[model samples]
Target: MNQNTKIYGLVLAGGHSRRMGTDKGLLHYHNKPQREFLYEQLQNICDAVFMSIRPEQQAELPRGFRHIVDENMYRGPLNGLLSAHHSFPEAAWLVVACDLPLVNEKILKYLLERRNKKAMATAFATRKTGLPEPLAAIWEPQGLRQAEIYMKTAASSCPRKFLLNVETTLVHPEDDLWVANANEPEEQQRLLAKLNII
Candidate 1:
């Protein structure tokens, strides 16, 4: 955690949750909405934190937390990341998805502590494939700029793919569970069982 670098947290909660059959961010896994939980956690480590949401979801956002609504028509997490980058192009974004129920302070601390300032981005490598996990990563200003340019072409929508072709510092997560995200009911149930919620 460089004291001079302004790192802002971006909680991605704009997804339509088509696979989950409900808003995954609004789901309760830790006695509070997962979005809220992640927001609180980010608040502790970031200079400031904002929720990435759609304009329609603004009304449902909890009060007192800052947010940036999608301005472009693009779908998926790229929209949230780029929206936040456009809003605050100077600060590096510590991006996290709302569906990651197992994300914790320790994991966040580890990521920040090991952030490679010189790399285009600092991300965790998936335990399964060793590919960069863009959502659980830090996107520097330069990286975001590159991403903006990439977005102009049809080849750069998928974040993981973008990471794969970029200069990213990939670290193995201390615990793979920290990066696990639940996108379906069955996955959510499995996570719930792991958390002893069932």
Candidate 2:
């Protein structure tokens, strides 16, 4: 890890959970809200932690937790990532989506330990599909800058696609469950069952 590039945590919670039919961030998975659980977990390792939310969500968050409202500058998770990047341009960000219930401290630590600063980003890739999981990856300052430029000419708003085309380091986690995302209602139920919460 480069001493100059500090790692800050950003929990992306601003998405419209239409498929889930409820706010995924507010879902109680580990006895607390899923987003808050991830936010607190990141506090243990990151220099600072923040939740990337929408403007309307600002009032919903409890005090003491730092938040950056999505500027809506870009699409998808990239909006939140860039908003945080714009706030602290020099620091690197360890980003996690709110829908991933299995993204615990161990998985986060694993990603951080394997971070390669020379690369644009150090992302977790699924062995099954060999696709990068941008939601649960570290975005270096340079990587974000490239992403910004990539967005300017690219029509696709997919973050994973950006990582796939860039000079990124792919890390395969020991457990694939660590990056499993609960996007729809069925997925939420299935993941909740896996967590023994259902």
Candidate 3:
């Protein structure tokens, strides 16, 4: 990574969680809100940490943590990712979604250790899917700039689609469990059971 560009941590907690039937960020799989757990994990590794949130979500947030409000310029995770990029254009954002209940501090440290600054972004990809997990990656400023361009196209708004065609470095974890997402209620329950939380 370039010395000029510091790595910052971003917790993606702006989703509506319509399918989960409640706020996913508030889920307590590890005795703390999932987003707070991620923020604290990132704080342990990155130069700084901030939570990406929707404008209305701010009031419900606990104090002391830094946050970047969504610009709402794009849909999906791109909105939070791009919003963080806009807030700190010079920093590389190590982003993690709030819906991921199994991701822990160790996995985040692993990602940082293997980051390729030369690549557009250094992302986690699973062997089973062979696809880049954009939300669980370090997005370089240049790559994020390209993502902004990619979003301009009417056909492509998804971050995974953008990363698939870009110069992102994919690092595979020992197992895919660390990157598992708990989007729907059932998925959350399954992950909770896996973690012995439920």
- How far residue 114's Cα lies from its native spot in candidate 1, in Å, is 0.9
Residue pairs with clashing backbones, model 3: none
Give per-residue CA lDDT, model 1, range 1-198, as digits (tens).
344669999999999999999999999999999999899999989999999998999888878989999986555688999999888888899999988888877788889999988788999886887989999999998898888788788554798888888899998986788798899999998988889988
| RMSD of each candidate relative to the true structure | 1.8, 1.2, 1.1
Worst 10 residues of 3 by lDDT: 1-10
lDDT of 3 at 35: 92
Residue pairs in clash, model 1: none
Error of 2 at 188 (Å): 1.1
Better candidate number, 1 or 2, judged by TM-score: 2
Tell how far residue 121 is off in model 3, in angstroms: 0.7
lDDT of 2 at 191: 88
Error of model 2, residue 73, in angstroms: 1.2
Worst 10 residues of 1 by lDDT: 148-157
Where in model 3 is the C-alpha error above 4 Å?
A: none
| Candidate 2 structure quality by residue, lDDT tens digits, 84-123 | 9999999999999999998899899999999999999999
Better of 1 and 2 by lDDT: 2
Q: After superposition, how far is residue 58 of candidate 3 from its true place, in Å?
A: 1.0
